[model samples]
Target chain A: MSLASRELPSVAATMAPPRSPADTPAGAISGPSWLNNLRAMLAKELLLEWRNLSRLGSVALFGAVTLVLFSFVAPPQAGARRMATAGFLVLALLLSSTLSLSESFRKETHHRALTGLLLVPVAPSAIFIAKAFANFFQLVLLAPVLIPVALVLFSVDLTATSGVSYPLLQLLAVWALASAGLAAPGTLYAAMTSDLRGRDVVLPLLFFPLVVPVLLAAVKATALVLSGDAMGQLGSWNLLLLIFAVVHGTLGTVLFGYAVEES
Target chain B: MRGKFQWEHAVLLLALVLLTVGTYIGLAVAPPERHMGDVQRIMYVHVPTAWIAMLSLTVAFVAAIGSLWSGKHKWDAAVVGSTETGVVLTGLLLSQGMIWARATWGVWWDWDVRLTTSLVMFILFAGVLALRASVDSAERRASWSAVAIIVAYADVPLVYFCVRWWRSLHQVQSTPETVDAAMMLPLRINAFGMLFLATWFIVRRARLELAQRQVEETTLPERRSVEEVQHA
Candidate 1:
């Protein structure tokens, strides 16, 4: 009874703010408008993320730690070291993405909170967009912390820009695109596997392979950003990253209803 | 969908006979290539398997779309069948490519375009199988697997393009002009043979999935009715 009551207020409160259910008679209103529902859900997602800022901190630390390990694995030679730096940094982002993606849905299992989200009758597309957008922004946030950590560890200075225009901005663009890539599919797969027993293993098994193009494109684009873009080929690689994100994001919106409705 | 004597048997027999003849002719009758010599014979089996692997996944992709739209058992079964067949052939294709690579490149593997794409494709589809294995609810299993298959299939073209951009050490694609006139017969024969063999495997797999589903329904009569109503 207590859990049911708690789940109802936040959902119902969004519908009618001034009047409680007791004051507003049965025929007083229909359910919340679709726009209201989406806004409420998005607000709820961001609010939850805001509440767990500490978790974000830990996840950043995790990404930083992975960066340190990647630096160790790179060869001692200077030329190869620069090449490996971009790949490893994006790889760290990809790996850290799995952590928070899984956690985002795992929280919904508490008192079956996701079931409440569904029972709130939120549109599945709205649900997916909210979840995917939150996850995407989370990945983007990691970039600020991780990029500096990578620069310090790899000892690459931005001021040494040769044939490169706006190195920092280019890196940010690639990071945003890569995060979009991971966020779409990762949120979808995490939604499916989060209800399973071996989710930790299952999520990565599905996610990592699906994002190979993202990893390759992002790594390549990042490499060009770090080094000089002699051939002027960075735009195409960044476009590839954008393509993956857009394709999966659209697909996920269409399919998440099916993946989530039953569970 | 079930009968005493199925079309799969005919396909199986035809595939067997064609494969035997094609292998014999490829081994003894076809003239050896001037460059790779006898080692090039592997292309007969290798190219056919690669073609059929793509076909299998395409079949899976179409079936995935079908399953999602119709929510039918047969579509789900085809998703399982063709995806499993695709994975098996991709594994075989990888090994065959490795043998060919060792003979030519003098290394077990290289980060060439097709080679890396094929390796990633193999892991990608195989991951679909692994995803399927972990889902316990039959309904969720069907939909989720279809979803995964579609999502995975979308990446194939993307992987091809990205890998091409990254690097291309693999040789140029063989066209009719490039391939020797004498080599065409075995290649055609093996390609058809492999196609039939893949069809037979898909039908057999779909039948097995249906049979298992039948056993489940019989065991859980109450749930079967519930599922029927759910579908209805």
Candidate 2:
């Protein structure tokens, strides 16, 4: 992530003295480099996210609720239920992600704490990375709660699925990939919309269509894990998810400065 | 200078003439497809509209980068104009596709890969516009909307591939060589005509956007009463 410092120039970069150490992160000056700052910021983010277990509880509950509601929408026919279980599980995660992401930036806004952090000379890239990782971890944590509930509610037995040698492991990997993909771009949009009016509507509006690739790939991969991957197509779908995560992760890191510089 | 004959008028006239001629030839001159019959004629307008919409989005992506890189109002205006044009053209393209689908496929909608991606593309750009609408400050609006457009533009390829991989019922893309000789003229003419029309719309829309910014920046406070001013 420190590699981003060379190419990054924000409102702060223009206003700060050129002789300052922030611009040149090669550690020539004794000041903290981008990586150190990123570490500190990431630690701060994890600490905050860790302190909010109750919040995660509510979000998990929301996911479970969404899972239940989705089950009701499908007919009781065994074949159709089995076919749709993967979609239901992923959609629950997708919906619950909005709940968690929208709140991730709220803590930063109180008392203009975000402005205070920016004043402390934290690189926006660091802040973005920290927030994205924290969000990613939070969503991953949801897998423990939501996946089991989904399996039970949908009457799915991963062990009985075909093609894949390790269905449970594959499903976990799919969840993590989807979470990472959602977290990167989700963090960026969440930051933009956090303080805006009608943010609830705006965040999902901007996010859902943009992350269609993630949703599609995750659902397909999960379905394959749950049902069968006779054509050995699971690897390709997982690759799509990884690509989505990487592209947006890099983009969000580079663009965060512009989005949050004014604040 | 206020009422001068401008280049936009010339572009607009050319677009209209080309569109009229192209539509006529597309409807009357081009031979119907062997299977779909005259229903294939919808492709004449639909294909051009799709091409122009995609082009407009590419322009929007470029302008988005320029806006973020330079922090210039002109770039922001271009972003607005191009994205708006893209959205409108995509809407028209979808409608035309639906009409063609209804005639041939016996349904108005299906989960075809290209169709899904196009719909998602439409929504993504529309979301950018929605974000722009909600922001009150012009600078923040410009920056945020540019960010949104960049993100959305980057997602386009992924969206297309993901949808395609998930389920693909749509036909493969058609090239000029695959098309009949008689269909080529109308397609080429209409493609150029749509491109020109999109340019005309983008230019005019950008001008209006820049004007709006000027109005916002130049609005002065109400004139104070003479007595109150003298006392101060």
Candidate 3:
């Protein structure tokens, strides 16, 4: 057989060349699954926050320090002490919320990973809801740390009042409602302002003003609950919170899409 | 020549003249409250300021939706201009509110839900304007501020509802469902008047800024941007 014929003899036996398209992964694990994607995004955000150990530490420390500072400003009387306690807790919530606003989405933006997160199929509102939940979690953890100091220093009445539930429940509700108020707009604005030069300064400028309604409602509601004032007023405060939640929640849901697009 | 000054400019000047007269009328022509005398003069500024703030936000909300859908720079300009004006008017209203509260409530400030929420609305827009100012890229600034406009617009109802939901020192004066004829006339007049003034101001500012930006872009050397584009 000639050299060319010898080389060609295997043509009948050999397989055709594999096409590039066929070789490509047919069912390869490209990215996370639906549930896993959401969880991973949320978990990644939380982990990034945790790694910044100093931010949370400062927030917790500030709440405690502020509680102690406000205690000194409180008078010895029962009503005054209660008022001071309520004021201090509300202020603590505001400060933490402010901190949350400034730092809420910093990790994602800093890592330049937000674009990747956005590429995921998860909804934008979920990101907002998850961030808000994270903020609420931080506040919940910080509250207990500050509560004992608040009680000890300010003599806040933590004992169950006649009509009001345990002081803890009332305070918790206040924090949750206020947290939602602060976080909704805070997250939205942070997302919007993340690309700005001075994001820290920009964040609070947008945050504190929009939080006025929630702060007022929270302060009054917390004050009423703490004072064991007319139970009727508590009902009103709840209604106020419901309004804020609905308005801001709807707003967040609607605008978050645009924000994510802008981001 | 683009008619040197457009009809809109003339209309704006006329509106300003009318607004000055309205201020005088509200402060001097209107009867003083029997209980809350001379200091009631503050209402002229307070009422007008509040009216303008809400009007500005309404414009912003419309402009936001417009820009988001149309992608026209004019709508974005409207959003920026109105938001800036809204924030300024809200701030003025807040300061006026503080003065009113000091006179009536015997305190300079109170944690009233309505007042606080209004302040929040002011801050929301302030942040918005800051967000707009801080960015050099027009597209990013417009798109981002548009997001802010929608977010802030959503808070309007929350601010409005705050007065009614919580026991607040600030009273809920007017609502579509609840307005009385006695208060409605002046309130309607003031509301419409303020709307006109806000639109006028927004258009005027937007035109000037847009023109300035156009001039700046045209004047920049082409080679610099072309080189930057190539490097990118």
RMSD of each: 4.7, 6.4, 10.8
First chain of model 1: TM-score?
A: 0.88
Which candidate number has the best TM-score?
1
Model 1: residue A225 alpha-carbon error in angstroms: 0.8
By DockQ, the best candidate is: 2
Q: DockQ winner between 1 and 2, please give it.
A: 2
Q: Please give me the total number of clashing residue pairs in predicted model 3.
A: 2
Clashing pairs in 3: A209-B120, A210-B120
> Tens digit of lDDT per residue, candidate 3, span A122-152?
4566566666667666666676776677777
Per-residue lDDT over B60-117 for candidate 2, one digit per residue giving the tens place of the 0 to 100 score: 9999999999999999999999999999999888888777767767889967777788
Q: Which sequence of candidate numbers ranks them by DockQ, best first?
A: 2, 1, 3
Per residue, candidate 1 scores C-alpha lDDT tens digits across A1-263 of 23333454465446323334544322221344545556666887787677777888899999999999988888888778877889889989998999999987877665566665666566778778988999998999999999999998888888795888889998999999999999999999999998787888889999998999999899999988999899889999989999999999999988998888763
Give the distance in Å from residue A173's predicted Cα in candidate 1 to where it truly belongs. 1.1
* Docking category of candidate 1: medium
User: What's model 1's TM-score?
Assistant: 0.91
